[model samples]
Target: MELKGIHHVSAITAKAKDNYHFYTEILGMRLVKKTINQDDPSVYHLFYADEAGNPGTDLTFFEIPNAGTTYQGKGSISGTSLRVPSDSALEFWEKRLSDYNVDHGGITRQGERNVINFRDPEGQRLTLISDETNQGVKGGRVWDHSSVPAEKGIIGLGPAKLTVQDPAPTVKVLTELLTFKQTGSYPSSFKGNEDIIVFETGEGGTGAEVHLEVRNDLPKERPGRGSVHHVAFRVDNEEELAQWRDRLQTARVPNSGLVDRFYFKSLYFREPNGILFELATDGPGFATDEDMNHLGESLALPPLFEHRREEIEANLKPLDI
Candidate 1:
């Protein structure tokens, strides 16, 4: 009946090739899946994660060639965090990002934890959260294969920052409907803005929390490259997901019900602020069609799209991995 922690966060990328190099090489995450966006076969939908493409570890990007810059503002996933092992890992990353010329805001504090904010080549806002004392839904283990040493490798997704004008409706949906508990509130650091509210579910920790920020100063977001498409929460199975679909419908929440993602079953819906949310099953994972050892090495298509692989491949621009 409870949604597990975060499943994955999907964002947009203008150049899949550069996104691949940065995520896999510089950030040292594994490109676990290379496939076409099922809804639009012409572009790539790349997945990056830990040693194995575990549910909580997934960070994905949809290729949108030549997309515009995302104007920083409200009604958006303002920041996405990647969890690391400890504070020392943050030290390694600070030097690493500087060495690679990655834009960063140096290490800072978010409550008791050490956080370093940074941006990708595409200007995607990101934060590295040090999991020094995290005790809830455990983080994924990074393999020794990553360019960054195993200890410093990014483990999994952390709290997603949702910025909006009004937080009451989103808070109601998360606490009342989705069962997330309002854990706490932290300073926004920006003068005159209200403190960011924290909500958690399942085993509640860095991995299962959502941080809501109120911002009346900014306008609605103009999403483009580097913009988050949605954030999904984990469900145990399709049966559980189906029950959730019924729950949403009963409440008249208006959701995309029972989608067969092949890798996972999903039900997508948006909160009152128009930020997308998804409930996704954790099984029939990335290994469903491809061998684990060879993941992301070649193009993968779900069974329904398998017959049209030739057409799909012809349309996608080659990502030189």
Candidate 2:
């Protein structure tokens, strides 16, 4: 199949306000859209990403206000890494983290790149690296809160790193179905890990490497805070999406029926290796809400939510964005 690239990564957040502030103020990601979780309208579903809020650029969150702390185990998404321009950017980011009293650690080199690892307010593990070669799509940074300067903020996605219980099945899916290529493997200097496998989608750089770290000792993951919600891959349109659905069915991979996700259509299923995966269509994008220029400033909903806007707005806790 001809996968365009990543669509978005969805994750769970315990509190709406904390997640909002972390993505907007600290990470410097724009709050592209805010609405209720379609599956459960009582909770908020927030998206953060580059300007345009393009598919591959987004990192979405589902706010389950009353959920308990997430247990970090095996079989769940380990962390997400964002790529910046150069190693120099890490110094600026380090200072920014310190300035905001957000805890972070020193740089550790990974193959050709140097990565800085940190955690969100909700304890989701995140990393930033400097990859000058693939400086992600150029755009403006939104959410100019005092904590994070507009410059040196996140430009776009880097790559999502997953620590799997057994990397074999996952590796098969990547190469055979998803069309990912095995880039190479590297030794990890980070504590408690040995080797990491790097997979590239498109001529790899930022937002391209899907790193898999194999740790046989760890127990399987139990999703909660600090765990990845789901990772989505892009399909050209409904036609291609249906093709992917048929492919999954032929392979006997369990899948969720086609569903409307407002901006795009999507199919959800667990990979043979257990990661939650979604195949989504590419159009009727963020522009569907407000004009492309005015996205994220106000509440935008899918057609289903538009009729309930008043009720959703009233139920959601007020956010300053």
Candidate 3:
């Protein structure tokens, strides 16, 4: 089956406020939408992305307040990386982080680009890299915010790196099912890691290439802060998503029953190597609630939650979007 590209990546967060602040204030992402988790209305589901709140542009989080602190282990998402236009953007980010009293590491060169590594309030490892050579090659949702100058603002997603116990099954799923092409491996600059496998879609930026590292030595990862909940890939519509669901069933890939996410429909499953995977439809998208021009400014809910807007808004902590 042909998959379009990446959708939004979702993760769990301990506190809603911290997640909101990190993704917006620190990362410079627009708080595209504020809504409650459909599965659990008591908690909030926040989406951070470009102004348009496009599928691939999003990084989402579900607030799970009482979950115990998570230990970084194997078999969980390792880190999420974002790509920028060039190394010059790193200077803006470095100064921005410093101004906010957020701590980050120095710049380091990897492959042909320079990257600056930093952690969110929740300790999720994030990087900003300058790769101007890769602009316009991939379509990105546009964000024309004054805070995010058009030039230096994030163009779109970069690869999400997964640390797995074994590479074979995951490799098979990536190559055969997901339609990712092997882009070879490289020695890792991070701790206790060796080679990293790179996979690229026809699009070549954040959502374009995903890097997988196999580390037998590290303990399995627990879900919490700094962990990726699931990575989602984009599909054109329900018809195409159904075809993918059938493909997964044929491969005996276990999956959660199809779920409607309002803006998009989703199917959740675990890859052979155990990293959670999601297949999500691209639209009817963020424009469903607020107009595209006013998205992410206030609470936006699906029709299901529209009736409960007052209650949901009351329960959610106030955030500056």
Q: Estimated TM-score per prediction? A: 0.98, 0.92, 0.92
Write the residue-wise lDDT of candidate 2 on 152-244 in tens digits: 666666777777877889999888877688878888655777778988774455565678888877787777766688888777799878888
Ranking by TM-score: 1, 3, 2
Poorest stretch of ten by lDDT in candidate 2 = 137-146
lDDT of 3 by residue, 39-151 (tens): 88878888888778776788888888886667886787777777677678778877887888776886776566677778777777777766656632363544766366666
Model 3 has an lDDT value of: 0.76
Candidate lDDT values, in order: 0.93, 0.76, 0.76
Best by lDDT: 1
- Every candidate's CA RMSD: 0.9, 2.4, 2.1
Worst 10 residues of 1 by lDDT: 312-321
Which residue ranges in model 2 land beyond 4 Å of their true spot?
135-151, 190-193
Model 2: what TM-score? 0.92
